[model samples]
Target: MIDKSDVETNVVVITGAAGLIGKAFVRAVAQTGAIVIAADIDLSAAEVVANDLQDLGKVETAYLDITCPKSVDILIADLMDKHGRIDAVVNNAYPRNANYGRKLEEVTYADFSENMNLHLGGCFLIAQKFCAAFKAQGFGNVVNMSSIYGVIAPRFEVYDGTAMTMPVEYAAIKSAVLHLTKYFAQYFKGTGIRVNAISPGGIFADQPKSFLDAYGSRCAGKGMLDPQDIANTLVFLLSDQSRYITGQNLIVDDGYAL
Candidate 1:
């Protein structure tokens, strides 16, 4: 049996809280009485989420640029200082305006490098910092957001007159993140810190209609999995309900891989 009270006062830091999936996670976890720090590159957007959760638990906001080591260090240090201990962290941030829909041939070196840096490098840096804190506190959870593309080939398509395709670089970086999760999980094992990944597929809500319709058609029955679906899974992983699971990737894609 899991005790909700054990986590009631614990602090959870969520990066990319302004993003679709991250916002959902904030809402779900807040209901459990955890103080949530909604961190994002966009402070205004993060503030909106924080305000909405104020009634559930203490909600705070921080501006975090995951690509910068100094930024991550400052945020982590402050959170640890104020809260005394960080119970969990969710690395849900990703580059917003990079070459997302381009193919490998069309992608510039800069584009590929940025994707790798944000997904793999940023995740590594944040995890290392948080693991250090977890070690001191003797308990923590690190949740990395991966994609279905991390484990499978990209399925390209055109929706509502706009072309949509998953890039090779994105897939490559996310794949590396999955392995990184395993590495961190093993390193933190027996130290009370758990590392894991959530690979979401076809999150279309709040997306452009054309993109949603086309992607929806392709996904059909198994195409569009709600952000709430992933959020629920995340809560379980962060909560003691999944205390025994670590170094693993949970795919919540409505069997899209099938």
Candidate 2:
């Protein structure tokens, strides 16, 4: 049992709060008594997550399209009015399936732009708005989600006697988010707002078996890392436990990168 007083009354805004990692994050922080604003493009999914955690702590569901500036601004303003200050924001929303394992030449420009906008542009806009709020309040945390592919190249694996490759756009956008984390962290230095990132290797929940099989083979036959692994790291970053850490990309890959 977590001590509620330790994290009580903190307001956390989590985008993509309906997905695997996002749901896990909601449960984790709610257990510690933090009020979570579950924001997602999927309003129904967000409502489910919010309802599930309502007994633990206050949760409000909001329909958020991170790709749209007006939508993002409206949500931020509403949260600010209601909560007075946002203690932290977990940017767990991703636009598309970057794990299609398509080759660079096979990936379309539309695919590249969509992924870039969600990962890079979304992070930039959210960080900018959240930092403004944090500046006024004098404290906040921003946790951007990245992938192990952001730090290293994907490995080729032979599956069913055929070689498969990871998509280039996935790697590119994640890599961009990693740097954006550093940029935001540095830009807001001494402002009491910490910006950081979590680069998870692979999370297997709800993924297609074929993709998992190929990825597992590439990872030396290991299972995907648990969502809890990423969630725990996120909680630490959002909590006072990581008050001194910023501009760092924390990897939670269970040695898949090794």
Candidate 3:
């Protein structure tokens, strides 16, 4: 039997809860009766999100700089003190440098390394600190936000007419996230903690029509997904419905990676 009651009382921390997908995740999770802490680097934006969804469920805003160890540690400590326990954490923060989407040849080594440190490194720090905290508490859940690019080679043809090209750093970070999910799940075996990853395809963000058509041709349906599509999957992972699933990557790309 599903633990619907337990799902209602979950206290989930969603990092980067102010971004496009992050906002949807906050709304979806909040609607499920979980107390959601919408943590983000932009405090005001996160607060706006919280206020907008206040009627949905329990939504709180907190400043979270995933790149900083001190920042990650502080949020964990404060939440533990206030809530007594953190039932789950979604590592959805997307940290990157100014030159993030540069084409392959145009990307500098410094830029690549910096982007890696910001995004992948941030994911690592969050998982490391939170898993340790989960260990002490004896139970927890972790959901890392990866990308479809992580699971398959980039189809550079899709970005042909546009100035857009998949960043190599993104592929590296997200792919690493997939492995990290497996690593944590295996390492924490028998502990009441579970870890998993979500690899979403290109989200509908008003890209050029040419790019959309090109990308759409490769999908089974709806080429570009809405943020809610991914958020729905996240709710499942956080809820008891997916209790026995762990260390797996759920791709919600409308079959783009097919």
Candidate 4:
């Protein structure tokens, strides 16, 4: 199939548009000439991103707290009314508390449940509403963001000389998201709806040198990922390029999973 933008009805809604990867996703999709809604909890930040991409394509910003159903409904409904269609949704918004990204011992039962519920529950609600609407409209696509930790066990050695112990809840939440993506793919098999996920490896960030070297040893080349790496794959999944792919968790971890 050719580009979905060829139809002039490609409107992509990306949640968490202010986050690292979220911003990259907006830019990548905007380059394709599709109408992109950079929805996020920080409306001002989203607006800035949309404004920066105005020259590339049609981009707009809106407030959306993916963890809130009413907020999700309001945004989607408004977008459909204004754009006439919402061809795809990238579920990349993650609501985290101040104690987020804590180590295993630092994690509480409450923290674990809260994070998982916020992520997986929000995905369920958003996908439910989007799918129901898409069912009547004829087609839709969803891309959930999982993590490499969701696929393979974390290498505890990488954090040996660093303060970077992966979050316990992160693995559980991402793993749940992977299965949920699969369930929706099967659940909506004949409805022209595609559900897929991206399981990303660690991206390059300011970490201890020891941690980086240790992690690098396990990778094929680069130890960390660039936001563009994930953005490229996201565009493919959202575009007609991957119209036939569904229920797949495509990993973009620089071979860290190997």
Candidate 5:
């Protein structure tokens, strides 16, 4: 039997490690004894996240601009030089333009294209570069952060009283990410590489009470998830326990997508 504690020695890279879900992933992976790279475009924020989790385990910070190929290359190179091997990478960055989040009717083509390029394009670049490194190393794991909205259409009724509407670009990007996971998994079938995605439900971010209630009605329990909820699932995917699972999208949306 493989000792799960062996994961403690693994080097894990999680992009967007300063953000909500990203921070949870960093904490969870660090707690497992893995050396975690809390990477984000905001170096200071990533450092703060690493500092907070240092006592739990080995946590490092790095500047990672997911949309920039040069930045991604540098990060991969630096980590390789320092850690010797990268066991897993979490494609969890969420990049977008200033004009993002507008309603469908208000969305411009330029805004949509730019947001897609930033978020989805960045996702592709991260997976491409990391998977290539994994191939050379002979083994690796990848976990992507998709959304429940990608699994199903937006429940627009939940936003009836809130100032939020599902961004069209988000739906497109996430849905494509699901397929992308499968693509990477299939393309690397013979290689010792595994690729998967996590589609999380709406995370609790202190939204309007009305919005929460409307959203809650759709869920069987805990309509809005905490960051840890999704993080736990990611840990499972990164572990050897899921060694045989690949080319899959695990939905962690608490039945909300049903």
Candidate 6:
């Protein structure tokens, strides 16, 4: 009975809109006629994405530093003033400083804590505030961005000669995100809000041929994925068709997790 047509019934907020995956999501959602808020810490980059998507549908750019409580407060207030309602939120961000992605031996306690606070903590803050608002309004959806690493350990063999090695913080943070999705889904049991997560595999970003070959061997077909692959799955989760789905972690990894 929901107006699933492109009638601007949904005001979707997406963090990390500057990244490849986030940008792809913005485009996909905008084309569906949702009032897309292409939010990112980098205001300029978010604006760029919003500008590109304006031709397709109603899209706006907003600054969001999810790690900061005040920034989160302002984003919600601003969105409320402009749109009056938020139908869904996509916690698709990876806020990090330079200390990330260091080798196992080089990582410090400070690095691990910082990454978790920004990534995991941010998701919590966003979900908490949105769930409260959604409870009052009586409907909402949340999609947390998780990783395939969270579902299965990394294949160290894939990075044998490449400069790429999985970041310890990422695995920990993503695992938490997946569990948090389940927690919130159960916690908001009676509320009309639904919480879910998506775990994506290695996306094709022009990696080295050797790395691609190694990774491909582990996948069902293509070793690496396109940003659109993840975006497509998100569309289904955000729509009314998925109204009955919640607290589930959908993996879009070309059978890599299997």
- What stretches of model 3 exceed 4 Å from their correct place? 1-6
User: Model 3 compared with the native: what TM-score?
Assistant: 0.98
Q: Which of the numbered candidates is closest to the native, going by highest lDDT?
A: 3
lDDT of 4 by residue, 1-258 (tens): 447464245898898899889989999888888888899989999988988878888888999988888998898889888878889999898887678788897888887888888877887877888888788788999899999999988788889877778888888888989999999999999999999999988877687889889988989998798899899889889877788999999999888899
Question: Between candidates 1 and 5, which one is better according to TM-score?
Answer: 5
Tens digit of per-residue lDDT, candidate 5, span 125-168: 99999999999999999998899988999989899978999999
Off by over 4 Å in 4: 1-8
lDDT score of residue 141 within candidate 2: 89
**Root-mean-square deviation per candidate:** 2.4, 2.8, 1.3, 1.7, 1.4, 1.8
Q: Write the per-residue lDDT of candidate 6 for residues 83-163, one digit (tens) a residue.
A: 788899999988887989887788999988998898899999988888888888898999999999998887888888988
Error of 1 at 169 (Å): 1.7
TM-scores for all candidates: the values are 0.90, 0.89, 0.98, 0.95, 0.98, 0.96
Could you tell which candidate, 4 or 6, scores higher by lDDT? 6
Pitting candidate 1 against candidate 3, the one with the higher TM-score is 3
Model 1: per-residue Cα lDDT over 27-83, one tens digit each: 887877888889999999999988877887677899998878899889989987887
Which residue pairs in candidate 3 have backbone atoms (N, alpha carbon, C) closer than 3 angstroms, thus clashing?
Answer: none
Q: Which stretches of candidate 2 lie over 4 Å from their true place?
A: 1-4, 97-101, 158-165, 206-222
lDDT of 2 by residue, 1-258 (tens): 344675677999999899989999988888778888889999999999988878887788899888788998899899888878889999888777554556777777787777777667877888888888888889988999999989987765522344455668778878989999999999999999999999998887666667677667656456587788788888788777678999999988867787
lDDT of each: 0.84, 0.83, 0.94, 0.86, 0.93, 0.89
Worst 10 residues of 2 by lDDT: 156-165
Which parts of model 6 have CA positions greater than 4 angstroms off? 1-8
User: Residue 110 in model 3: shift from native, Å?
Assistant: 0.5
lDDT of 4 at 203: 78
